[model samples]
Target: MENLLYLFILLALGKISRRLSAFPENTPQILNLFVIYFSFPATVLLKTKNLNLGTDLAVLALTPWALMLMTVLGIRLIAWYRRWDRKTEGTVMLCTGLGNTSFLGFPAVAAFFGEDALSYAVIYDQLGTFLGLAIFGTLVVSVYGTSTRPSIKQIILNIIGFPPFLALTASLCLMKVTFPLPVIKLLEGVSATMIPLVMFSIGAQLRLRQPFSNVKPISLILFLKMMVFPLMVFFCLTMMKVHGPVLHISVFESAMPSMVMSGVLAQSGRLNAEVANAAIGYGLVLSFITLPFFDLLLKMFP
Candidate 1:
């Protein structure tokens, strides 16, 4: 409960900063880069080291893959049926299909599930959602993007070049070898910035003006992201006989808002940036309601 409060407080602070013009507009971008390259990797390395790998963990890691598959198929069929343009289809696909697994995800999971279970959230973010963003995300952007279609080689290289992916590799290598206590402490201190910085960044970028104008698509996006997608994850994982923390954490992470980075991707890719940004803004606000509801629903599972 206190953890959730901390998130809201930090978010309010960021919103306040935005309203007061306390920082340069580009500040969030730099903060995002730091979280991606420095804070996020540090958290992953520290948490995942000395971690045990198992089949259930692998299933957790694969959750986003399943979600993305469903999203792509669903969006393509819907677009075909509705005769939506490529850009609109791609925008919705990116925003709704992916999630804010890292930023909002880390803190929310810690708040709801506690620190001990954070490693599961890490797996869901890095292995599941991050992987989707790097590979599959790029594919969606390219296919729908006005930019020249990138070669397959470029896609592989881009994934390899991502700092978090590199960190994942290094962390795997270091799993068997213990680090010095001082180094571990250093990593922990840096990684701790992830939650606050992420929430603040989200708040800073929020723009609520005319949010209701795009109500129809935003409503659909939220339904898929906040409710339908998470429920789908729960039923699928439950049928596999997976229960307890793994099932709970996976579903909770799925219920997060649209990825903030998805809006950036939409703009850069020449997709419908307006819809993407609207989906993100509204999704972030609505998630506070849906997340807790799903948390209670998952508790009823077993």
Candidate 2:
């Protein structure tokens, strides 16, 4: 209960910052850089280091990739049938395909499931969603993005150099070895900044109104992202007999709103910003309703 309030408060502050001259226009971007470079890696290390490497870890990690693949294929078919332009197709693909599995995910999961479950959330985010952002997210943006596209070589370099990816690598290497107490404490401090900063950054970027003309595409995108996709994942995993926190967290993370970074990418890539930003903004708001509904739904399988 308290955690959810924190989420809303931070988000409200970020949104309010948009109206204040004291908060610079680039505030969200600056905060994002800190999250990307420092807090994210630290959180990855701390959360994942002691992870049980338990049952269905593979399934948990693989889940987001599967979600992205399905999202791309599903949207492509819809886009083709609708004869949507390339930019609109790309915007929907980018926004709908990526889940806010990290930024909004960590705190929300903690609110619903307790902090212990966050390790699984970390696994889902870093190995699955975040990697998807770097590789799959970039690919969508490039191919469907602006005419100014990055080369294959440059893309590979980026995935290799991404900071959180490096942190995942380091954590994997150090998993078996115990860190010095001081080092763990240091990591914990830096990582603790993740939730507030992430929420603020997301709120700062939120835009409630796009043109009313945007209604249909935005509606379609939200349906897939927040509703259909997660339900699809839940049923499939249930059929495969996936249960426990693996079943719970995977479905929970999948149902998150559009990735905050996806909107940023849409704007940067010169896709349809109106659709992309609106989906992200509205999706976040709607998740307050959708997620609890999902939590109720998941209780049946668990």
Candidate 3:
């Protein structure tokens, strides 16, 4: 719980800074760049370099991918029913489908379930969530965004060019090689920066005074992210006869808020940045309570 508290404190600090103008306007963007290019990849390498590729590992890796696929379909239905504009539909789709698996998933899993379960969390983040964001998320942006649609070649290049994906590939190949203890320690030290940096970035981007027009979409995003998405993951995984810690972690991750980067993507994609940012801010605050409730519900799994 201390870790979670620290995360909240960092977020509050960031919020305070933004209100107070503690830094330049571009600070958040710089922090995000550091996270994307350095901290996140370091964390991925720290966690996955020693990973063992096995049957269960592959299945655990599937959780984020599977849940996201479900989310895409769900959002399409919701968008159609609501007759949402192209921008709103795309923004909602990104916010509801991509989860805060990295920023929130790691520390929360370690706190609630113990560090032993972190590998599963890493698998979900690196293999599933990160790839989804870097690749499929880009495709969604192109299709629904005001920007010209990217060709298949651009999509593949985006995935290939992602630092975290490169790190994943390197880690998998180097799985058999042992890093020097000093190198491991350095990587671990850098990995430690990810949570605080990410939390602060999220808070910096959060806008508390959302326009009234966005309330409905934000509400729908919360429901899908905090309740519907996780429940879908739980039901599907359970029916597939998956059990134990992997199942628990997967469900817990799905229940998390939208990825912090969704708004950035929204803006870059020329989608509805307001709605995407609002969804993330509201969804994250709600997750503080919803995650615990979901944890209790998971305990009921027989």
The number of the candidate with the highest TM-score is 3
What candidate 1 gets wrong by more than 4 Å, as runs, is 56-58, 79-91, 100-146, 211-217, 237-249, 259-281
Query: Candidate 3, after superposition: displacement of residue 69 in Å?
Result: 1.1
Candidate 1: give the clashing pairs: none
Return the number of clashes found in candidate 3.
Answer: 0
**Winner on lDDT (1 vs 2):** 2
The better candidate by lDDT, 2 or 3, is 2
Candidate 3 lDDT at 229 equals 77
Error of 2 at 252 (Å): 3.5
Tens-digit lDDT string for candidate 3 (1-302):
56556767877887887867559887767776777788867877876666455676776678777777876788889889988888888898888888888767888888778899888888888777876876667767767775555677776666677676688778878888989999988888887877677667667766778878788888888898889878988988899898888789889988988887676677656788778867876776787899998889888884
What TM-scores do the predictions have? 0.74, 0.76, 0.80
List the lowest-lDDT window of 10 residues for candidate 1: 206-215
lDDT for model 3, please.
0.78
In candidate 2, what are the lDDT values of residues 1-302, reduced to their tens digit? 45556767887898899999999998877787787788877877876666554554999889989988888899899999988888898889888878888768988999889999998998898778876776676677667765455688766666567676678778878889999999989999999987678668767876676666678789999999899989899999999999989999999999998886676567655688668766876786798899999999988876
Q: Candidate 2: TM-score?
A: 0.76
